[model samples]
Target: MATRTRRAPPKARTTSGPAFEVDAARLPPLGMPPAEFLRDYWQKRPLLVRNAFPGFVSPIQPEDLAGLACEEAALSRLVAHDAAHDRWMLRHGPFPEEMFPEMPDHDWTLLVQDVDKWDADVAALLAHFGFLPRWRIDDVMVSFAAPGGSVGAHVDQYDVFLLQAQGQRRWQIDASEAMGRTAPPLDFRDDVELRLLQRFNPTHDWVLGPGDMLYLPPGVPHHGVAVDACLTFSVGMRAPSAAELLGDFVDTLAADADDALRYRDPGLAPPKSPGEIDADAMERVVEALNLLRMNDPERLGDWFGRFITVYRSGGQVMPGEDARSRIEVEWDLQQGARLHRHPFSRMAWRKAKRGARLYVNGAGHALPARDAARIADNAVLDGPLYASLSEAGRDRVFELMREGHYHLDLRQDDE
Candidate 1:
């Protein structure tokens, strides 16, 4: 499927004036300082912050969500539960307009992934969570549900901040670590997409209004039913398992390695039984594998840089940023114009004293020591900040802009 660039322009029009500000302040929504929250709750337990975003209005309407679902490159699904028949149904989307209206009125949900990639205002909300490492952040998934509608009780492996963007939803969360262990694993019907636990004994339950947020850690079973027509924005994080990380890194390493770098058997010994592998052979294999330096400082940095900076498969896209030339962009930046990172672009880095491994998209590049360190410190360079940089620093700025991760639009009339 082709990637979907948002119908909405990168710039939003403001009423009466050009001034447009959507976020209140870059503060932890839960009233705790970022340090305190990260230390106490992140990946450790659940935290509910009521009206965390005070006077917050949803950036997009329910209709907007449905419209996006009809587009190619949109990963969407329709989930329905039939109470009368005691059956659950799941369907993938690119759904036709008529299909939604025909869905059961009171027990269905429409979920669309990476809304921030499509809407600037929705993407602005991510800046609020700047307290966390930006590389670990994933896309913002938006879901709309009918009254009494839910996706079922299932546990997510990664952490999620379920922000109620519109109307209200009743959330029932199972705090018990067992994920409601009722059986070895009961056979669920074919209709469900998740291994939904049948009996969910919730320790935390609440009806969340617009702007109300719930933070759930990994492995906690959670179920949410809409109290009325509503929209929920799930700010998800990446939490790859150790095995997954190693597997991908191994694949990456092998791609660049010489085919002749194979196992050496200089001291071969015959086994007593041909079917029985000797422990000496196994030891030799382990030693050869260890030589790959899976844990070496140099290789670890490379793996971390590429793994965290890969673009989401079907997320948002920024226009014209990649097509611009460095000198042309540097000239524009010299005029004191603003450049912002595209909402859909994922950028992260690993720093060293002399330089840094700055990864944008799936590729890693070396950055000047100061420029890289400053990004690690502040993560962005706005107009004034760009002016503050030396000529070398400003040139580095142009490189990021040309790469398409950071965007600049000269079409807008002087502010």
Candidate 2:
């Protein structure tokens, strides 16, 4: 059977005005000093902070989110539940615009991940979370649900901040440690498409209004049901499991290993039984595997730098179609042009013995620490910053720009 692509919803006009801002003096984004919150609640307990973004307004409307969901490259999902049968259904997108009108109004949700990468206004919210390491942030996932809509009770393996962007959602949580009790069994219902908890006993419950936020640490069973048509912005952290880390780490070692590096049985005593694997042989296996261990600090850091910058979706950052000379890029920047980081590019930097190395979309560039920091810290580069870069830094920037890690912002005038 031939597969047909669905038509995307019409693009909505971008929100006009100053980007979202947090007035720290009035009400902090975390409802208290960042350090205080980190010390008390971060990964240790759940917190319900009122007016985290006082007088908050959603950056994108439901329609705007629906439009993005229809884009072919979007990581989107539609979840619906049949309350009568206690059954749930899941469907991936790009969904057709016509599907929205056909959906029942109150029993389903539309979730789109990495909304920050898709919309600049949504990305601005990340600036307020400076208390945490920036690289730890996975992405901002936005979900729009009608009244009574929910994905069902579930637990996440990573930290998450559930910020109410519009309307209201009643959140129920079971933080076992904080409640001073044995944790609930981490079991899932086999019948549903979602990984919903088979059993949920929430000790804390609250209804979040616009600007309110809930911070949930890993392993907390929670559920959120929309009170009405609403949007929730989830700022999720990246917490790879031991298995995932080891897999990638070993893969890197295997790629760099020489063919000659192999297990040796110098003191070989033939096995008592040819079919039996002796303890001596097992010890040799352990010794052979130890060769792949990254003991040096620099080697460990280098491996992690490359690993973490890779997007969860494994999206590639392609260079611009037309590569420009360094001189051309410099001239354009001087003429009020701004260079924006590619949405798919994940970037990080590490200080080296000499200076630092910047990693973008799995590739590294050696440069001064200051220059590397500048690139990692600022997603958009402008004239003053460009001119301030050291000769080496400028050259690296030009190279990255040519490679499409950064591109000249065509929307600068509109901004």
Candidate 3:
């Protein structure tokens, strides 16, 4: 099979707004000293700026965004209301334009979630915001709202930055603590709208034209209604809960284990009435799971990194012919070849054992080592963070990166 070549990093396009510049010089240095705007105001409160991206045009056009919504494979939703009846409805799509003729023009929205799944251009736009660790990076979700379209008062569990690419939107934000009381029902309808008890205007509210941006911290209750046809890109952070981690980690363990780890029924005898799962059995199962989680920290990190990197997108990367041939080659750690985690990926923990070798995406290799510094550095960095490696190391790293099993150092691209 033909292998996909790595595309050259695209040139950084200039935008007009000074606030939107993400270069290192433009950003506040570590410690986020008291004077920095982002350190002082971000997520703690709402920030609105006019001309944030001065010359910024919508990365993806509204029509194109809509076109994506019409694909059966796309994740899209339509929110609409009948002003005459004061009734609201949400529809999932594959939508056709004709569905909106009867609804008032400005009272609805068509949202295309996870734009990164469909548009590589949008994904690149997301990459620019990777100031945070890539492992915490979440997918980009885009919404095209018509006039007066709103998504009711809601609070997200993770941080989000709302970037206005075109038109204007009126946003209302409130303390996230008020969410449980103010939030509309999961199935809330227009007739029984959950009312917000507290409200705050954008301490910096303004008509956001193309390039404007708003950053909101998780748990902040906010609502947005378009004042005109608008396109909004929501760059959200991923905040996985303990339950989600347990589910995925457990699934990974089950896949790796050849022996069935089924709950053993002690076959206990007679009580007056039969009951659901016994307490003793439950304790045994929990103990077994705890044992699994308590693997050597370094080994755990290697396994978790490989598991996360390979399945980050819910897609699998199978070995190719070249990969099969190169499987047994010895890798040089001193030369600096390393398997780096995806920016947004997360690890439950790390556990290392003797002779523990990591098979990335089930194709690439990360040889085990005894050096704590090297292991930590290699696992934590998004791409390679070390300096130049020996030619053999570079070749090995290149082959893995080429196979989409790892990411090499950014500087190495020039070499």
Candidate 4:
């Protein structure tokens, strides 16, 4: 059981922020390591880095991002003011040219969402942060904020790192406690769509130039205004609410319900009226949901894992054409085989059972009795780790990765 350590340059400490190097070693380890940062501040504070990505190329150019706004296929927005003085305005695309009529070059901006969806290069750029669990990884959102352009003050439920690739932007962050005390209901007006309740001034205010980055944990209120035109890449983390979990879980249950899954109301009496959903019926629904939660935890994890690993709509992975007949191939977990959950994926209430079994795409296969330990080790690893396995285990792992059930960084290429 040898851990596969990432060999890269160590992160260089800077007076202003975290060291910026292309290699993993140069950057702080992904996610908040418990020992490095205290628990309260780990996912609940703001951190600023003067230089986060050294030698980093702007993943999307400002002009290129603007061009994307013009295309119908792109998700863009325009936010501007229409008043004679002290006006506030905001707009989002796919936008047409008329939306920018005589627009002040400095006060307007075009924000494009999900750039990683279309650009593989940008997506690969993000994969470098896989030091964090793939399950918690969210999508990379890009905003080309122009001077006077702002999304208004707001709080995000998930953690985010704002990486400045070009120009300068002014940012203001407020603690969650302060924001909670005076938070206002979100308003969507025609003039100023997003409103802020608290005012913020950076204690360490300075223009963030290229390669700088800012990290904000969930619930921290923050707002950014472009001091000049700039490109900001947001690496957002995923955090689902209980309501969301229940909704998705219900959907999964409905899809998998057996033919004999009709609700039974054995204690029925002569109804006073035609029909009604009585307390008994409601109780039955609740009971069913409870049953799902109480089911074998291992099976639940397998179900959720499958859902989490599948690609998003229109995001496809092609298996090697020559490997169509390769059912007996081997999978080397030590070679970087790991599960990558989709950003929208939801976690299940179930945890893997105390046995050696591999599940992918809603299907499960039992591991051989002797190799159970190895299989279990791979399944529970929070980060990448390696273990040698028999041919059967390898084949199963390879097949799963090839199907895009998860990602496998093969150590040896089979020619």
TM-score of each: 0.83, 0.90, 0.61, 0.64
Instruction: Name the top TM-score candidate.
Output: 2
In order, candidate lDDTs are: 0.72, 0.83, 0.55, 0.56
Estimate candidate 1's alpha-carbon lDDT, on a 0 to 1 scale: 0.72
RMSD of 2: 9.3
Ranking by lDDT: 2, 1, 4, 3
Task: Assess the local accuracy of residue 317 in candidate 3 as a C-alpha lDDT between 0 and 100.
Answer: 38
Cα lDDT tens digits for candidate 3, 1-415: 1221222221211312223223222332212233464564554444444344556677788888878888886778887766688566778889886554554668888888768756767766755563565545567889988888876656687778778777777676543232223432333233534333233332222345556666666666667888788889887776777787777777777776646555555775675557666676688788666655636566456655665544435334333343422333223222343454443322221224553343444322434332222332353332233324334444544465455545433233235
Segments in model 4 whose C-alpha atoms lie over 4 Å from true places: 1-34, 38-40, 67-74, 82-104, 176-206, 258-294, 310-351, 354-415
TM-score result, candidate 2 = 0.90
User: Among all windows of ten consecutive residues in candidate 1, which has the lowest summed lDDT?
Assistant: 1-10
lDDT of 4 by residue, 1-415 (tens): 1221232322222223332222222554333353543343447446665546665678668667766778776667776643258566656577666655456777666667667665656666565564456446666778876676777666787888788777777776654342234533433335445554344433233356666677777766677888777788888776777676667677777777665655566877787665787777799888666654527666466655555544232234444333433332223433433444332222221234443555443355666533434443333321233235566755654555465444433444342
Q: Name the candidate, 1 or 3, with the larger lDDT value.
A: 1
Query: lDDT at 402 for candidate 3?
Result: 55
> Between prediction 1 and prediction 2, which has the larger lDDT?
2
Local lDDT at 132 for model 1: 81
lDDT of 2: 0.83
TM for candidate 1 is 0.83
